[model samples]
Target chain A: MATITYREAVVRALAEEMDRDSDVIFFGEDVGKAGGVFKVTPGLYERFGPARVRDTPISENAIVGAGVGAAVTGLRPVIELMFADFAAVTLDQIVNQAAKMRYMSGGQIKVPLTIRAAQGGGAGFASQHSQCCETWFMHAPGLKVVVPSNPADVLGLLKSAIRDDNPVVFLEHKVQYTEKGEVPDHTEHVVPLGVANIVRRGDAVTIVATQRMIGVAQQAADELSGEGITCEIIDPRTLVPLDMATIIRSVQKTGHLVTVEEAVHAGGWGSEVATRVTDEAIWSLEGPVVRVTLGAGIIPFSEPLEHHLIPHKARVIAAVKRTLAV
Target chain B: MSEPLSAAMRQQMLQRMIEIREIEGRIQELFLENVIRGTTHLCDGQEAVSVGMAAVVDAAHGDTVTCTYRGHGHALALGLTMRSMVAEMMGKVSGCCKGKGGSMHLTDMPNGLIGTFAVVGAGLPVTNGAALTAQTKGTGALALGIFGDGTPNIGAWHEAVNLAAVWKLPSIFLCENNLYGEYSPYADTAPVENVADRACAYGIPGVIVDGQDAEAVYAAVKTAADRARAGDGPTLIEAKTYRYRGHSRTDPAAYRPEGELDAWLQRDPINILAARMIADGQITQAAVDGLKAQAATDAQAAIDWALAQPHPPLDAVHEDIWV
Candidate 1:
């Protein structure tokens, strides 16, 4: 067992996958000499060389398209988009080509590509760099959405996604990259998709979160424990083939729920979880579901406004309090 | 017949053109006859571009090709069985896409044909994606994307080419410049004279070849293929050809001027190539006539096969949603 930050765990997973398979390659902006903007791919360039760990131009379309092409033709490509917002520039290649090639060709082709993007809002990077666009991918069929909330899950899920035969959208929270945690010592550890893990057992409220929000949920749970409010946190590793059953069962047991995400409140993953909770386990709820999310307005460049744009522990704790009211 | 066809390759090219022309013609006739369903686009005048370009890429390399809505000629040139194509158009089970992809969605993956899309500028990115795959996987294969002159104006076209150029992707962008985009003339839509001229913007080689001449198109594309194989990056080729038919089956081409059609008809690619073949003593009159007869027979046989194929079951609609 080793203590590693979420970022180190991600880098370790990538290195292990590249070492295990000769066909696995990595490419993106600043991934070469700089080890990526967040250092999630640090030391990969020297280890794999330029051909395998390439630094591409600032073209997001090429970054993603090259991965799609390479994946379909035999190579397993892990492409990094500097920020989640940049995926919009490669939508044609990602949504139209990579996501649909398997079905479009009537199963004649398989796109075993992994697209990694940094998400979450903090550090005042403002609007362009901090949006959690996981919903955009979750809405798109033929894609697997993975957002790990801890170092262990990050390592395990990243390995699983790399091994998946279909295209995967792996989201890493920029805020949680430096958060330290203990991961399994086994190099072959992998978590299956569509399974939600109960990080802390409780009965008062079920706090469902993704990526950075998972850490926020844990903090809220720790704080709420003093008030006799035992919060149960569930981290859904994969969003596309969502483990709705686990969430629903938790809601059924707790009778109250608080969902959190880094994206704007409207049409975000929080909204998705809330809708599913209401549809499947509404009768079990003692109070209305609380959603802690980024403010609806555009992410402001100012430090205070950008901080306000995202949901911090205070907001999550407040949301928990509201859900437990009465 | 005088050029260098030898009555075989020339014969095959003509049949492919006719199949495209007739399929479009028949699509119109069938629409008028009320047998075929949905919209129809014809490649009546620009047959040389798709057919000629396909001659350079071999299927054994696992190469891929993408095309736009004006893709009948492209589908045929890529070696999709005529019977499967016609069946697909007829929405039959035995069709290429099992009738899911109508005329605009013809595909034959076994032949290394990626598939066709109806979106105007969509194929460029898809082609680039495929080319990226070939380059990264060490496939030594190439990808060809066939689009019209109007596509260059779309953001995808620029993005696709820029990406291909920077990555040195093994791809070719074949511009079938028939000089028209729906009702608008090429002069009004395009800012430049030749689409190939824009290649320099991306730092790639540009070639403007005679669109009507099969041999010329083959030669130009051959060079691009060689460059791609040699890791010289992508090339943009503008085939300045004219379409003999309307943009779609029902179009009367009311926007065209009177002598414009006559002028293009005078330079018909098939006639010029055939005349050269005869002048050069490459083929005899009887041989040329026999080639045409053989094409007709082959076309009829394809029609028979297509008609006999069974319709796909309704359950197939739910399949292949994901891999």
Candidate 2:
């Protein structure tokens, strides 16, 4: 195992995949010589050359539409949208063309396409640049949604997403790019989709989270353990094929559930998790499910306001306390 | 100047156009009879553009064609079985897309008709991607994007054209200027009269052709296809034509002015081809009539076959969502 930053892990996975498969290609705005705006795709253009690593014009719709076209014609294209908030610009390509092509073609084609985008707030990128829109894709059928919290999970999940037969919306939190973790040294390591990682095991209350919220939930778990309130922290890496079984099992054992995410609480992924847990394990639950999320409001550019709006360790702890009190 | 097509190729083009016209006519009849439900965007008069372009590109040789929703002509010209297409419209299990993709979403990848997108200008970038795949994989193939006149003004079209031109990708952007973007007149939406003129902005060759004449479309597309295969980058070919029917099944075409439809009808692609075939001493009026009769018979046989096919099973709905 080798310790690496989340950004480095992303580049490592892409480079390793490109080395392993000639069919894999990468493209996006400033992805070539500039090595991406966030430097997550650094040195890929030099290693893979212009043929595989390309810099596309600033057209999100075309970028994603071209990726779908390339994928159906036998190329695994990893397209970057710079930010997840820009998914709105390419909604037709992602929701209509990429997601529905396979099913529409009667399964004659397989779109092994991966769309990588940085999401979530806390970097003061404001509303238009920072939004966790994974739920929008999760609601759409024929799409796989992956949200990796740490460096290791990012590497593993990205590899799996690249190799998967379906189109995957791989979201990486911008704030987590500098966060470091021990990633598997080997190139072949992959974390399969639809499996939740039990980051911390506890029986007092179950805290289910995704993306950066996993780190927040873990911090809350650490604090809750000292207060004699054990919290089981479950990180559901992929949202579409959610590891609901693991979440339900944890909820059954703990009899209390608190879901956390960086996206707004209204119609967010946390609501789905809460609804599912309540529907299936209502009898086992000793309290109502609490969802710790950003309130229904736009993310401001001010650092203090942004921090206040986004879900943090304090919010997770409060949600846990609220659920525990019930 | 483009080389003249042979007598045999002209006859083949005539037959293909006739087949499309007859098939669409039959579909109109079916729609009127209330046999086939749901919406269908038919290309009754703009047959020459699709047939002419399809004649130049060898789909069996890996060339791909992406077209708009009004793509029955494109599908039929690309050699998709009439039975499968009609069955798809009928929503049968034996349809081309297993009844999943109806008339608007018809697709046949083996014959290289990638997809018929309902969204305007949506397939331009997709076609560019196909061209990119061919270029990257060293496949000697070209992609053709067929859309209406209004699409060129959209962001996807401009982006796709610029990308294809910059990358020097092997592609042909064929715009079938049928004089209307659904209900609106083309002149109102576009700044230039000829859609081909817009290609100058992208630094690619642009040419205008008489879409009513099949030979003209074939020659223009052939030149463009040859240029693409020789790694000369993409070309924009604007086929000036007119659609006989309304945009969709529900349209009454009251938006068209008096004498406009009649003026376009005089330049009908099938009639022009039939007249050309007779004047070239390739066939007599009697033979042309015989061919039309044969096409109608063939279309009827396909309709009968599609009618015999069963509806898709309930379990099949759950299938094809993945893999």
Give the winner by lDDT. 2
Candidate 2 regions with alpha-carbon error over 4 angstroms: none
Off by over 4 Å in 1: B1-7, B32-35, B249-251, B279-314
Candidate 2 lDDT over B1-323, as tens digits, reads 35657889888888888889889989988998988888898898899998899898887788998999999899989989899999999999999999998889899998898899989999999998899899999888999999999898788899899999988999899999999999999999998989999989999999999998888999999889989988999999999999888989999899999999999999998888788778878889898888899999999999999999999999999888777
Model 1 per-residue lDDT at B170: 90
lDDT of 1 at A54: 85
lDDT of each: 0.81, 0.91
lDDT of 2 by residue, A1-326 (tens): 89999999899999989999999999999999999999999899988899999999898987998898899898999999999999999898999999998888777778899999999888888889999899989878999999999999999999999999899999999999999999877889889999999999999999988878888888888887889988899999999889999999998899999988888879998899889988898999998789887778789999999898888888888888888883
What CA root-mean-square deviation does each model show from the true structure?
Answer: 2.8, 1.2
DockQ of candidate 1 against the true complex:
0.47
